[model samples]
Target: MQASDRYRLSASATWVASVQMEPAIGAVAANLARSIELVEMAAAQGAQLVVLPELANTGYMFESREEAYALAEPVPEGRSSQAWIALAQRLGIYLVAGISERAGGRLYNSALVTGPDGYLGTYRKLHLWGDENLYFEAGDLGLQVFDTELGRIGVAICYDGWFPEVYRRLALRGADIVAVPTNWVPMPGQTRDGAVIAHALTMGGAHSNGLTVVCADRIGTERGQTFVGRSVIVNSQGWTAAGPASVDQEEVLLAPIDVKATRRARQLNDFNHLLRDRRPDIYDEQSGATAGLRQR
Candidate 1:
């Protein structure tokens, strides 16, 4: 409320939501129906940006690569993608959802982004986890930061959040918010404080990068694998803006995010800035990541 703090914001705040739901295996029709319903609910509650869980269409746990291909569809033009685009246009809001994308005779775990203007772009998941390697190709699309009326938005999938580099790279590319569509499972070795492994990852990613992180995770067991369902939204200060919802329920976490303040939070105190303080002059990725970005 102080006049000096006005520099933390450049425009109005945006109301966003993380829609947590359970999608069934290969049940494209049913999953699409349910996801549409939940997005509508979030919009009804005044969400300008709504994010859905990973594999929001065909679900996780494919029986085979053949099954995965059978359930996957093309990007933007796919029936599922078209439906979601229409929903975003109708609601006059931005929507991000996970989909099983079939492209170039290969299958990818992808997220489709849409807005009131229509289809925006697709982000193929960079890090494939567990059985994902067996069925889906590791994401080919590099870090993509989408500029929208609300702000600069970015997308990441489940396993991608595990790497600090992913968040760091997105922040470096000028992203204000990172929408994570995840299907989280339990991490081995419980902590003394009993914090959720996912909480540590998302909150840390947000605080270190000064980005708002909105995660929508799925629940339920399919083919003997259970998903941990504590969906959450983390603010730039590494604090909970909304949830870490129930471990067994379907829920929608809605919150108002001050994106400009988040971007400004990168400046800690009067002397240090998170991004500017990086010692990239002496340190290097050594993993060839910079070369890849340059090629792109």
Candidate 2:
């Protein structure tokens, strides 16, 4: 092999881990400004990419389905996403953010990933938790992953974190990291001071899938509901680079990540190798009952 070829292969990986936690139920204009402020700050701090909390532009709690509908907006065409794309271009950094997305005539909780080049891609929340079913429609699309200056990354909105398979599928398909933008409601009867369940879900998904998982969430009380804002970054080994938690203020959180570590971990443990070891021959419930001549 040529010396230049070896040098290129050995080039160091450059990336950043960052999150923005918006104050819950805050005014739209205020939230947007805070988000923009953080975007610029993260870029100045050397972040190649930044992720803001789920529904960071709008608070998560709702009084009725109509309220959620009122907050929803079309992607790229909507005010919130348009601002995000423009900001990404301005800062020349990749951005991942969650928003209430409007489609056709209904709304779906969704996440969008944008790069300096332009708006890159989006993913809608596929698994709606209890109360969410009452307001948002579940997205039927499969997991999405895209290439960025940092690395190949996948986006999964809130409830999607509970299902480890989502991360597994993305990692198997070549995602080096997964970004989760969430508005995590505390479990049934747990006190806010108790160990955060959402962080556990995020770390579990990352460790099991052999990838780093970064999450951003909103904080403060909104419409009679309260959230424990602990926006965090977790490594493939399930360790928190930041603490166990943080508050829901309009704050910028940053950490450094080594992309090469993700590849090495996957090669060593290969926890997600199950994607290739599946036995489809006996898994017939997915389609025709009689297997003699299954319909295409």
Top lDDT prediction, candidate number: 1
lDDT tens per residue, model 1, 112-184: 9999999999999999999899999999989899999989999999999999999999999999999999998
User: Pairing residues by index, what is the TM-score of model 2?
Assistant: 0.84
Which runs of model 2 end up more than 4 angstroms from their true locations?
Answer: 1-13, 23-26, 269-296
lDDT of 1 at 253: 90
Show model 1 residue runs off by greater than 4 Å.
Answer: 1-11, 190-194, 286-296
lDDT of 2 by residue, 79-167 (tens): 88999999999888889988888888888888878989999987888999777899899986679889876888988888888887788
Tell me how far the alpha carbon of residue 142 in candidate 1 is from the true structure, in angstroms, after superposition: 0.3
lDDT score at residue 183, model 1, on the 0-100 scale = 95
**RMSD (Å) per prediction:** 5.6, 6.2
TM-scores for every predicted model: 0.91, 0.84
